[model samples]
Target chain A: MTGFELPVALFLLANLAASLWRVLRGPGDANRLLAALLFGSTGVGILALLAFSQTPAATPLLDVALTLALLAAITAIAFAQRAWQRGTDPKRADD
Target chain B: MTSALAFDLLLAALLLLSAWQAMRTPHLGRALLAFVVFGLLMALAWARLDAPDIALAEAAVGAGLSGVLLFDAWRAIRNKPDSGKNAGDEA
Candidate 1:
Protein backbone atom coordinates (compact mmCIF):
# COMPACT_ATOMS: atom_id res chain seq x y z
CA MET A 1 0.00 0.00 0.00
CA THR A 2 2.80 2.36 0.83
CA GLY A 3 4.41 1.61 -2.48
CA PHE A 4 1.35 2.88 -4.30
CA GLU A 5 1.54 6.31 -2.72
CA LEU A 6 4.45 7.69 -4.72
CA PRO A 7 2.83 7.28 -8.12
CA VAL A 8 -0.31 8.95 -6.87
CA ALA A 9 1.76 11.84 -5.63
CA LEU A 10 3.45 12.07 -9.00
CA PHE A 11 0.07 12.20 -10.70
CA LEU A 12 -0.97 15.07 -8.48
CA LEU A 13 2.23 16.89 -9.35
CA ALA A 14 1.51 16.45 -13.04
CA ASN A 15 -1.97 17.79 -12.49
CA LEU A 16 -0.47 20.81 -10.78
CA ALA A 17 1.90 21.41 -13.67
CA ALA A 18 -0.98 21.36 -16.13
CA SER A 19 -3.10 23.75 -14.08
CA LEU A 20 -0.11 26.03 -13.74
CA TRP A 21 -0.62 27.08 -17.34
CA ARG A 22 -3.81 28.81 -16.28
CA VAL A 23 -1.88 30.72 -13.69
CA LEU A 24 0.73 31.72 -16.23
CA ARG A 25 -1.64 32.76 -19.01
CA GLY A 26 -3.83 34.85 -16.76
CA PRO A 27 -5.55 37.87 -18.20
CA GLY A 28 -6.07 39.21 -14.65
CA ASP A 29 -4.59 39.10 -11.18
CA ALA A 30 -7.66 37.49 -9.63
CA ASN A 31 -7.42 34.62 -12.07
CA ARG A 32 -3.77 34.00 -11.19
CA LEU A 33 -4.61 34.14 -7.49
CA LEU A 34 -7.33 31.57 -7.99
CA ALA A 35 -4.74 29.30 -9.57
CA ALA A 36 -2.50 29.84 -6.57
CA LEU A 37 -5.32 28.63 -4.34
CA LEU A 38 -5.51 25.52 -6.46
CA PHE A 39 -1.77 25.06 -5.92
CA GLY A 40 -2.28 25.26 -2.16
CA SER A 41 -4.91 22.52 -2.14
CA THR A 42 -3.00 20.29 -4.52
CA GLY A 43 0.07 20.79 -2.38
CA VAL A 44 -1.86 19.46 0.61
CA GLY A 45 -2.75 16.35 -1.33
CA ILE A 46 0.87 15.77 -2.31
CA LEU A 47 2.06 16.20 1.27
CA ALA A 48 -0.51 13.74 2.55
CA LEU A 49 0.59 11.16 0.03
CA LEU A 50 4.21 11.62 0.93
CA ALA A 51 3.41 11.23 4.60
CA PHE A 52 2.05 7.76 4.02
CA SER A 53 4.63 6.59 1.52
CA GLN A 54 7.47 6.20 3.94
CA THR A 55 8.26 2.82 5.50
CA PRO A 56 7.51 3.91 9.06
CA ALA A 57 4.97 6.45 7.90
CA ALA A 58 6.06 10.01 8.57
CA THR A 59 2.96 11.20 10.39
CA PRO A 60 4.51 14.57 11.07
CA LEU A 61 3.97 15.37 7.41
CA LEU A 62 0.28 15.37 8.14
CA ASP A 63 0.92 18.32 10.42
CA VAL A 64 2.71 20.01 7.57
CA ALA A 65 -0.28 19.35 5.34
CA LEU A 66 -2.59 20.86 7.94
CA THR A 67 -0.45 23.97 8.13
CA LEU A 68 -0.48 24.23 4.37
CA ALA A 69 -4.25 24.00 4.30
CA LEU A 70 -4.57 26.71 6.92
CA LEU A 71 -2.14 28.95 5.10
CA ALA A 72 -3.96 28.45 1.82
CA ALA A 73 -7.21 29.55 3.46
CA ILE A 74 -5.57 32.61 4.90
CA THR A 75 -4.05 33.49 1.54
CA ALA A 76 -7.39 33.29 -0.25
CA ILE A 77 -9.11 35.39 2.38
CA ALA A 78 -6.38 38.02 2.35
CA PHE A 79 -6.37 38.20 -1.43
CA ALA A 80 -10.12 38.56 -1.71
CA GLN A 81 -10.46 41.12 1.05
CA ARG A 82 -7.31 43.20 0.95
CA ALA A 83 -4.90 42.74 -1.93
CA TRP A 84 -7.09 42.75 -4.97
CA GLN A 85 -9.16 45.75 -5.97
CA ARG A 86 -11.83 45.77 -8.63
CA GLY A 87 -10.88 47.24 -12.01
CA THR A 88 -7.21 47.28 -11.07
CA ASP A 89 -5.09 46.01 -13.90
CA PRO A 90 -1.85 44.54 -12.63
CA LYS A 91 -0.22 45.25 -15.99
CA ARG A 92 -1.18 48.86 -15.73
CA ALA A 93 -0.19 49.04 -12.10
CA ASP A 94 3.48 48.78 -13.01
CA ASP A 95 3.24 51.36 -15.74
CA MET B 1 12.06 3.18 -5.87
CA THR B 2 12.19 4.56 -9.38
CA SER B 3 8.85 6.24 -8.91
CA ALA B 4 10.14 8.02 -5.87
CA LEU B 5 13.04 9.33 -7.87
CA ALA B 6 10.63 10.44 -10.58
CA PHE B 7 8.58 12.36 -8.05
CA ASP B 8 11.67 14.09 -6.79
CA LEU B 9 12.77 14.98 -10.29
CA LEU B 10 9.39 16.47 -11.15
CA LEU B 11 9.29 18.45 -7.91
CA ALA B 12 12.71 19.84 -8.64
CA ALA B 13 11.67 20.87 -12.13
CA LEU B 14 8.63 22.66 -10.78
CA LEU B 15 10.70 24.45 -8.19
CA LEU B 16 13.02 25.74 -10.86
CA LEU B 17 10.17 26.67 -13.19
CA SER B 18 8.24 28.63 -10.56
CA ALA B 19 11.35 30.39 -9.38
CA TRP B 20 12.24 31.37 -12.91
CA GLN B 21 8.74 32.62 -13.61
CA ALA B 22 8.74 34.63 -10.41
CA MET B 23 11.90 36.43 -11.38
CA ARG B 24 11.17 36.87 -15.07
CA THR B 25 7.55 38.03 -15.02
CA PRO B 26 7.15 41.72 -15.72
CA HIS B 27 3.87 42.12 -13.84
CA LEU B 28 4.46 42.62 -10.13
CA GLY B 29 1.30 40.83 -9.10
CA ARG B 30 1.99 37.86 -11.34
CA ALA B 31 5.55 37.66 -10.11
CA LEU B 32 4.27 37.70 -6.55
CA LEU B 33 1.81 34.93 -7.36
CA ALA B 34 4.60 32.87 -8.88
CA PHE B 35 6.65 33.48 -5.76
CA VAL B 36 3.86 32.11 -3.58
CA VAL B 37 3.76 29.02 -5.73
CA PHE B 38 7.50 28.68 -5.47
CA GLY B 39 7.39 28.85 -1.69
CA LEU B 40 4.75 26.14 -1.50
CA LEU B 41 6.74 23.90 -3.81
CA MET B 42 9.84 24.51 -1.77
CA ALA B 43 8.01 23.28 1.29
CA LEU B 44 7.19 20.09 -0.53
CA ALA B 45 10.78 19.69 -1.54
CA TRP B 46 11.81 20.02 2.08
CA ALA B 47 9.36 17.33 3.08
CA ARG B 48 10.76 15.02 0.42
CA LEU B 49 14.25 15.67 1.68
CA ASP B 50 13.26 14.27 5.11
CA ALA B 51 13.05 17.63 6.83
CA PRO B 52 9.55 17.89 8.21
CA ASP B 53 10.48 20.76 10.50
CA ILE B 54 11.88 22.72 7.62
CA ALA B 55 8.78 21.91 5.59
CA LEU B 56 6.57 23.31 8.32
CA ALA B 57 8.61 26.46 8.59
CA GLU B 58 8.77 26.89 4.84
CA ALA B 59 5.01 26.57 4.51
CA ALA B 60 4.24 28.97 7.32
CA VAL B 61 6.91 31.57 6.88
CA GLY B 62 7.91 31.21 3.27
CA ALA B 63 4.53 30.75 1.69
CA GLY B 64 2.08 32.16 4.21
CA LEU B 65 3.70 35.17 5.82
CA SER B 66 5.86 36.05 2.86
CA GLY B 67 2.94 35.86 0.47
CA VAL B 68 0.92 38.26 2.58
CA LEU B 69 3.86 40.61 2.83
CA LEU B 70 4.47 40.57 -0.91
CA PHE B 71 0.82 41.30 -1.58
CA ASP B 72 0.99 44.27 0.76
CA ALA B 73 4.05 45.49 -1.11
CA TRP B 74 2.33 45.06 -4.41
CA ARG B 75 -0.58 47.13 -3.21
CA ALA B 76 1.71 49.83 -1.90
CA ILE B 77 3.71 49.91 -5.11
CA ARG B 78 0.55 50.13 -7.14
CA ASN B 79 -0.57 53.13 -5.15
CA LYS B 80 2.69 54.99 -5.67
CA PRO B 81 2.70 56.19 -9.26
CA ASP B 82 6.27 57.39 -9.33
CA SER B 83 7.84 54.17 -8.07
CA GLY B 84 5.59 52.02 -10.19
CA LYS B 85 6.51 54.03 -13.26
CA ASN B 86 10.17 53.88 -12.41
CA ALA B 87 10.06 50.14 -11.90
CA GLY B 88 8.40 49.68 -15.25
CA ASP B 89 10.92 51.90 -16.91
CA GLU B 90 13.78 49.92 -15.42
CA ALA B 91 12.22 46.60 -16.43
Candidate 2:
Protein backbone atom coordinates (compact mmCIF):
# COMPACT_ATOMS: atom_id res chain seq x y z
CA MET A 1 0.00 0.00 0.00
CA THR A 2 2.76 2.41 0.90
CA GLY A 3 4.57 1.64 -2.36
CA PHE A 4 1.45 2.39 -4.39
CA GLU A 5 0.93 5.59 -2.42
CA LEU A 6 4.12 7.25 -3.58
CA PRO A 7 3.31 6.70 -7.24
CA VAL A 8 -0.16 8.22 -6.95
CA ALA A 9 1.26 11.16 -5.09
CA LEU A 10 3.84 11.69 -7.78
CA PHE A 11 1.21 11.62 -10.50
CA LEU A 12 -0.80 14.29 -8.72
CA LEU A 13 2.31 16.33 -8.11
CA ALA A 14 2.96 16.33 -11.83
CA ASN A 15 -0.57 17.47 -12.56
CA LEU A 16 -0.10 20.42 -10.26
CA ALA A 17 2.89 21.52 -12.29
CA ALA A 18 0.90 21.34 -15.50
CA SER A 19 -1.83 23.45 -13.99
CA LEU A 20 0.71 25.99 -12.77
CA TRP A 21 2.04 26.29 -16.28
CA ARG A 22 -1.45 27.05 -17.53
CA VAL A 23 -1.92 29.76 -14.94
CA LEU A 24 1.42 31.33 -15.86
CA ARG A 25 1.11 31.15 -19.62
CA GLY A 26 -2.59 31.67 -20.14
CA PRO A 27 -3.12 33.90 -23.20
CA GLY A 28 -4.77 36.91 -21.64
CA ASP A 29 -6.84 38.25 -18.71
CA ALA A 30 -9.86 36.00 -19.05
CA ASN A 31 -7.77 32.97 -19.88
CA ARG A 32 -5.58 33.51 -16.86
CA LEU A 33 -8.64 33.80 -14.62
CA LEU A 34 -9.99 30.62 -16.14
CA ALA A 35 -6.68 28.90 -15.55
CA ALA A 36 -6.72 30.04 -11.96
CA LEU A 37 -10.14 28.45 -11.52
CA LEU A 38 -8.68 25.24 -12.89
CA PHE A 39 -5.87 25.51 -10.41
CA GLY A 40 -8.39 25.55 -7.56
CA SER A 41 -10.01 22.39 -8.88
CA THR A 42 -6.63 20.66 -8.95
CA GLY A 43 -6.10 21.67 -5.36
CA VAL A 44 -9.22 19.67 -4.57
CA GLY A 45 -7.81 16.68 -6.44
CA ILE A 46 -4.53 16.89 -4.58
CA LEU A 47 -6.40 16.89 -1.28
CA ALA A 48 -8.39 13.81 -2.21
CA LEU A 49 -5.25 11.99 -3.30
CA LEU A 50 -3.47 12.95 -0.12
CA ALA A 51 -6.29 11.61 2.03
CA PHE A 52 -6.14 8.30 0.22
CA SER A 53 -2.40 7.97 0.61
CA GLN A 54 -2.08 8.98 4.25
CA THR A 55 -5.31 8.45 6.15
CA PRO A 56 -8.16 6.01 6.31
CA ALA A 57 -10.61 8.82 6.95
CA ALA A 58 -11.00 11.31 4.12
CA THR A 59 -13.75 13.41 5.67
CA PRO A 60 -11.58 16.24 6.89
CA LEU A 61 -9.97 16.92 3.58
CA LEU A 62 -13.24 16.45 1.74
CA ASP A 63 -14.78 19.12 3.89
CA VAL A 64 -11.92 21.48 3.27
CA ALA A 65 -11.99 21.01 -0.49
CA LEU A 66 -15.73 21.54 -0.66
CA THR A 67 -15.51 24.75 1.31
CA LEU A 68 -12.72 26.01 -0.87
CA ALA A 69 -14.67 25.30 -4.03
CA LEU A 70 -17.70 27.18 -2.84
CA LEU A 71 -15.73 30.19 -1.71
CA ALA A 72 -13.65 30.25 -4.90
CA ALA A 73 -16.74 30.26 -7.08
CA ILE A 74 -18.28 33.17 -5.22
CA THR A 75 -15.06 35.14 -5.32
CA ALA A 76 -14.60 34.62 -9.03
CA ILE A 77 -18.10 35.83 -9.75
CA ALA A 78 -17.64 38.91 -7.59
CA PHE A 79 -14.43 39.83 -9.36
CA ALA A 80 -16.09 39.37 -12.72
CA GLN A 81 -18.83 41.76 -11.73
CA ARG A 82 -16.29 44.32 -10.62
CA ALA A 83 -14.33 43.91 -13.85
CA TRP A 84 -17.48 44.71 -15.76
CA GLN A 85 -17.90 47.86 -13.77
CA ARG A 86 -14.52 49.22 -14.79
CA GLY A 87 -15.07 49.38 -18.56
CA THR A 88 -18.28 51.34 -18.03
CA ASP A 89 -16.57 54.07 -16.04
CA PRO A 90 -15.65 57.04 -18.26
CA LYS A 91 -13.12 58.59 -15.93
CA ARG A 92 -11.16 55.32 -15.73
CA ALA A 93 -10.32 55.28 -19.45
CA ASP A 94 -8.05 58.33 -19.87
CA ASP A 95 -5.88 57.73 -16.84
CA MET B 1 14.44 6.16 -0.22
CA THR B 2 13.09 6.15 -3.73
CA SER B 3 9.80 7.60 -2.59
CA ALA B 4 11.49 10.35 -0.65
CA LEU B 5 13.64 11.16 -3.63
CA ALA B 6 10.59 11.39 -5.84
CA PHE B 7 9.03 13.77 -3.38
CA ASP B 8 12.12 15.93 -3.43
CA LEU B 9 12.05 16.09 -7.20
CA LEU B 10 8.41 17.10 -7.26
CA LEU B 11 8.98 19.86 -4.73
CA ALA B 12 11.94 21.17 -6.67
CA ALA B 13 9.97 21.43 -9.90
CA LEU B 14 7.18 23.38 -8.21
CA LEU B 15 9.66 25.80 -6.68
CA LEU B 16 11.35 26.39 -10.00
CA LEU B 17 8.12 27.11 -11.90
CA SER B 18 6.74 29.50 -9.29
CA ALA B 19 9.98 31.39 -8.82
CA TRP B 20 10.47 31.91 -12.52
CA GLN B 21 6.89 33.12 -13.02
CA ALA B 22 7.09 35.43 -10.03
CA MET B 23 10.32 36.99 -11.19
CA ARG B 24 9.35 37.60 -14.80
CA THR B 25 5.67 38.59 -14.86
CA PRO B 26 5.03 42.31 -15.42
CA HIS B 27 1.32 42.32 -14.70
CA LEU B 28 0.19 42.51 -11.10
CA GLY B 29 -2.98 40.51 -11.74
CA ARG B 30 -1.09 37.63 -13.32
CA ALA B 31 1.60 37.62 -10.68
CA LEU B 32 -0.94 37.46 -7.87
CA LEU B 33 -2.72 34.65 -9.65
CA ALA B 34 0.57 32.77 -9.94
CA PHE B 35 1.36 33.26 -6.26
CA VAL B 36 -1.98 31.76 -5.25
CA VAL B 37 -1.41 28.83 -7.54
CA PHE B 38 2.00 28.27 -5.99
CA GLY B 39 0.50 28.28 -2.52
CA LEU B 40 -2.13 25.71 -3.48
CA LEU B 41 0.48 23.45 -5.05
CA MET B 42 2.69 23.74 -1.99
CA ALA B 43 -0.22 22.74 0.25
CA LEU B 44 -0.56 19.49 -1.67
CA ALA B 45 3.18 18.96 -1.33
CA TRP B 46 2.75 19.31 2.41
CA ALA B 47 0.08 16.62 2.37
CA ARG B 48 2.49 14.36 0.52
CA LEU B 49 4.92 15.02 3.34
CA ASP B 50 2.31 13.56 5.75
CA ALA B 51 0.89 16.78 7.09
CA PRO B 52 -2.90 16.70 6.76
CA ASP B 53 -3.93 19.52 9.08
CA ILE B 54 -1.41 21.84 7.54
CA ALA B 55 -2.66 20.91 4.11
CA LEU B 56 -6.23 21.71 5.08
CA ALA B 57 -5.32 25.12 6.39
CA GLU B 58 -3.16 25.89 3.41
CA ALA B 59 -5.79 24.94 0.87
CA ALA B 60 -8.71 26.60 2.60
CA VAL B 61 -7.08 29.71 3.94
CA GLY B 62 -3.70 30.18 2.34
CA ALA B 63 -4.46 29.29 -1.25
CA GLY B 64 -8.23 29.45 -1.68
CA LEU B 65 -9.11 32.47 0.43
CA SER B 66 -6.06 34.41 -0.59
CA GLY B 67 -6.74 33.70 -4.26
CA VAL B 68 -10.12 35.39 -3.86
CA LEU B 69 -8.61 38.43 -2.25
CA LEU B 70 -6.00 38.84 -4.97
CA PHE B 71 -8.52 38.37 -7.74
CA ASP B 72 -10.53 41.18 -6.21
CA ALA B 73 -7.43 43.32 -6.06
CA TRP B 74 -6.73 42.56 -9.69
CA ARG B 75 -10.24 43.67 -10.58
CA ALA B 76 -9.69 46.94 -8.82
CA ILE B 77 -6.23 47.45 -10.29
CA ARG B 78 -7.03 46.70 -13.89
CA ASN B 79 -10.34 48.53 -13.86
CA LYS B 80 -8.78 51.82 -12.89
CA PRO B 81 -7.13 54.52 -15.01
CA ASP B 82 -3.39 55.10 -14.96
CA SER B 83 -3.87 57.97 -12.55
CA GLY B 84 -5.94 55.79 -10.27
CA LYS B 85 -3.89 55.16 -7.13
CA ASN B 86 -5.11 51.59 -6.83
CA ALA B 87 -3.73 50.55 -10.21
CA GLY B 88 -0.69 48.29 -10.75
CA ASP B 89 0.66 47.54 -7.31
CA GLU B 90 2.90 44.45 -7.50
CA ALA B 91 1.79 41.23 -5.92
TM-score of every model?
A: 0.89, 0.72
Worst 10 contiguous positions by lDDT, candidate 1 chain B: B82-91
lDDT of 1 by residue, B14-67 (tens): 889989999988766677778888999999999999999999999999889888
Shift in Å, residue B36, candidate 1 = 0.6
A81 Cα displacement, candidate 2 (Å):
3.7
Q: Model 2: per-residue lDDT, tens digit, B1-91?
A: 5865786687778867886776677766666766766676667666666676787787777676776677676676665678455454322
Residue-level lDDT of model 2, residues A3-45, one tens digit each, is 5665666776677667667657754456555755676576676
Per-residue lDDT tens digits of candidate 1, residues A1-95?
54889999999999998888666765766677677679778999999999999888999999999999999888777776656775467364432
Stretches of candidate 2 above 4 Å error?
Answer: A1-3, A55-59, A83-95, B1-4, B82-91
Lowest lDDT sum, 10 consecutive residues, model 2 chain A, at A86-95
What TM-score would candidate 2 get against the native? 0.72
lDDT for each of the candidates? 0.83, 0.64
Question: Could you give the DockQ of candidate 2?
Answer: 0.40
